[model samples]
Target chain A: MLSVLLASGVANGLLYGLVALGVVVLAKAANAFNFSQGDVMALGGFVSYAVIVTMGYGSVAALPIVVIVALFVGVLSYLLLRPLMDAQHAVALLTATIGLSFLVKGTIRLIWGRQGDYFAVPPLVSGPPIILFDGAVIIPLQHLVMSGGAVLMLALFALFFRFTRLGLFMRSVADNPRAARIVGIPTELVLCSAMVLSLVVSAVAGFLLAPATLIFPDMGFSLFLKGFAAAIIGGMMSLPGAVIGGVLLGVTEVLVSGYISSTAQELSAFVLIFVALIFFPRGLFGGRSSRSV
Target chain B: MKLFSQIVGVMLMTTALAVPAFAQDVQGVSDTSIKIGTFGPITGANYAFGRLTMNGLETLFADVNAAGGVNGRTLELVRVDDQCDPAGAIAAVRKLIFDDQVFAIIGGSCSNGVMAAKEDIEQSGIPFVNFAAASNNISAPEIENIFTSMLTSNLESALQAQYLSDLGVKRVAVVAQHDAWGSDRHKTLLPALAEKGIEVAVDEELSMEANDATAQVLRVQGSGAEAVVLLSYPKPASIFLRDAARLGFTSSFIGTSVIPDPVAFDEQVAVPGATDNFVTISPSRYALDSAEAAEWLEKLTTKFPDDEPHTYNLYGITAGQLTVAALEQAGADLTQASFIAALEATSGLETTFAPGPLNCETHQCLQAAAWIKRTPEGKTEVVGLSTLD
Candidate 1:
């Protein structure tokens, strides 16, 4: 039971981490907390559902379509937030994104309202459960894929932030937006790029998680709240903290559920967030410097 | 002065005689049409229950109207979105009563929402025919003007327990939602199972939005139960089934009227053969694609082009049939009181797709349900019938 709970927790936690990663990136690079990150992820999943289910295309075909749609959505989101971004009003930006969240949710509901309560997206790799301990403990193939996808995405982002010119620009902006602007970094363009990158990450997470979560309009707000809790636990501005926080939350939820009760599992994420905020205000990995690493 | 006093006395007598005659006229009834109001969650997570049922009511009304109208009165439906909430249901019912002035109501989809507005409905003295909301309290206490055609939660719970008991399942696992809908059944189910000499090995709570049920599955597997009773909507149930299959925890799964269509449920689970041992209790005897329901399905498809035929729609059609029967029985000099009387007097009323005759002894009309199973080849078959004795 412990092994099964641990495995399940880690797998779910990684997916939540991917959602947090997108949230932390926007919070860092754009100096803005995007409330709609979860909805954006839901949009990605539904778009992929359309590709894979409605259009009768495979998961491979849905990826490019998701990326293209994410690009358009990210750019549009930047354009909508541009004026407020210039003013640098945190509350205004946050408020606007909440509205964006509603708009996105309403749009998704409108499009897929009559389809069903929940739509299934077949796992990327279709096969049986991976047996361990002579079938005493079994891990689903999709869980493994989901975990690997999260790790791979995390690694790819790490490489990009460390090696790419665009990554440098984003880091500079995160350290000090005004300073980066002074150094001839097109601040608006960089922020736009950050939004795009964040959404793409979130969209990819949606595609990976869709098999487990299923596709539904109401899935957004709950996932958003979970991701937000994860981001806060990890420190809102710290990327690595977000991932760690997500895994911690996921594991805690599973363990609590396995050992304690199912009702406690739902409360575990919020409780953890509360404890993290009270004890480690800057998070476990958060540094004194405002810059996110 | 004497002439003026005499004239005023005559005028007062004339006004007093006319008041009773005008007061007898119903609010939504006219010579040419009978306007009925319906409320459900046209939007939100439970829209399938609400929206599709509303569509069914609409289609049924259209069919009735097309058939030369109901006793020279064309049925007009007035729908309001309840948002599947208690407050929303109250507002919707109030709007129907005070604003729309609908003569009678023919729908109530969300259990909690409808239950919330029960007092208001009872107080308003309007005839309310409940379509899909199955909280036992909605009609079991026997409100004079409220009648439910759907099998009440208590009946379904009793039937589920009986079915499990008959299967010789001594130890059973239960996974139910803790919300109003689930609580209504779960509260009754515990005692029902006990009465059947079935021991509840494990009890778990699942939320409406829950995507995973691994921990619950593991716990259920550990319990060594012979069967599992799912007291949730299709989403959580589907997740539980899929997770159960993934973890190789196989057991006989039993569900209630909420999962009406076995074929749709099998598809929703997405795992091949996951629903092999799954059987659900449905109020409708006929499947959506069954030969008996082909004509009604055609009518539903013709009215709502984008929607595929659903059991929820059939529920609404049943409600409409009940309302029209009561209306026809009420006679042309229709009023709220007469409608209530007609509904109360209606017994052994058979309608399209109903599992049993709707006999409103305690305002809970349908007491029987049919067990539905989906074949591996995607065919929904009715295995058997169970009626509460």
Candidate 2:
């Protein structure tokens, strides 16, 4: 039971964690929530489909095109906010991102059209399953890959933040933008870099999910909600917190669907989010939060 | 003076002949062309059905027109977009009748939407040939002008139950969404299963919007059932298979009508070993191997490239057959009453529609559905026709 639960949890948790990274990349470094994050993820999948399916590039071979689209989306997002950033403190920036979300989703609908595309992904190297107890439950190679992908992404993200100059500049901008600007650090470029990183990470998440779940336009909404729940549960500012939050959320959904009922699966996370907000507003790990007053 | 008298005499004769000429009900005559209105969701999630249905209907109309149309007049189709919504459907009916002044209505894509429009459609004294709506409500005794061209869920489940019986399965499990649609299917299907002496070991419910059906599957697995009957649409059906595979549960899986669709079959096969055990209930004619269906498919594919030769595609063609037959029966005048008379006159008429055409009475479609078969490479095929319990 444990193995089966974990295996199922891993496939879903990995994608959720990867998406949560988008939140961390933007919120932690730039103190912005690109409300269009989910829509952008969907757009990436559609763009990938357009390249791979419509253009007849093999699904795996379409990676270069995916990266190009991701970069373009990043630049487009920057342009979307460049005007808003001039004023800076208005909640209207978030609202504009919401508008951007609709525009992107609608544009994708117009360009890709609304039909389910069954992508032909390469077969995962499946191996003989290892039995936990009864032959009823066995672990497969794909489960391991999913778990490994999540752990590797989490570790790599941590390392990137710890060891890189661009990462350092992003943190400096997030921490003290005025000081960084006075010190002659190019804060705008740092912010732009943060947005691009977020976009690339989200695009990767989209690609990862497409192989498992057929790409649908409305797919990102539920995923986006779960990712946000993980971000909050982990402490909005902590990357590790987001990963734990995501895995916990995925497992919680499965468990609730298993033990209580599947109907209550969606309601579980929202209820958890509400309870967490009431009790621990700073999340389990996030200590002190600084907001621009 | 003689020439002037002759001219005046011809003019008087012409006026006398032209005056009071509109008499004798003129066979089934309208002012100009025979106007038939159609309702379908042209721009919503179900737009594919609507678009393809219209395409098929137009192809038939084109062919009819090429043959000098029914009794010297062309068929003019006034199309309306219902967006697959009930209210939208009601408005569509109102517009088709009150605004467009159509002679008859045909080919609505959804069941519930068409059911909601039943009252106004019947009240308007217009004949409605329902192209795709399959709920029993449309074909029940009360609605007069409505004629169903698609098979109902009840018919589908009975067909599936009988198919499983033929597979020698003695016990089955059901995982259905906790909703009216699922419950209606369960109600219709369980009796058929009981008749086959197949005990239902587990009956489970999952919400329509639920993404995971692992817990539901575990319950079914624990019940020790031999075969699993999935009462679901394609989305939840695919999700259930994925969750089941991940949990490493292996059981023969049977699906609802919408579940084992060719497009959906490809998606479900991605669910790790789901292809091996997957089976579904579909009409026999949609089966690629149906030798009798060959010529029909040849014509359908030539006309509609995107639309596979599915049961619904047959329904569109059947609608065309009925429409043309009705127009012909309506005679030279082509009145609405004559069209309804033509529809009522429908019997065990044979056509390329798979079934020996449709018998208007008992509303029992002669073409019973078929057994589920899986291709070696995970593509699905509808097996040969079997008895429906």
The candidate that wins on DockQ is: 1
Residue A253 in candidate 1 has what lDDT?
A: 90
Score candidate 2 by DockQ: 0.22
**Per-residue lDDT for A133-216 in model 1, tens only?**
886776777778889888998999999999999898889999898899898988777889888888888888888888775678
What is candidate 2's CA lDDT for residue A6? 62
Residue pairs with backbone overlap in model 1: none
lDDT of 2 by residue, B333-353 (tens): 555666777787777665464
Question: What is candidate 2's TM-score against the reference?
Answer: 0.83
**Top candidate (lDDT):** 1
Model 1 chain B poorest 10 in a row by lDDT? B11-20
Candidate 1 local Cα displacement, residue A265, angstroms: 0.5
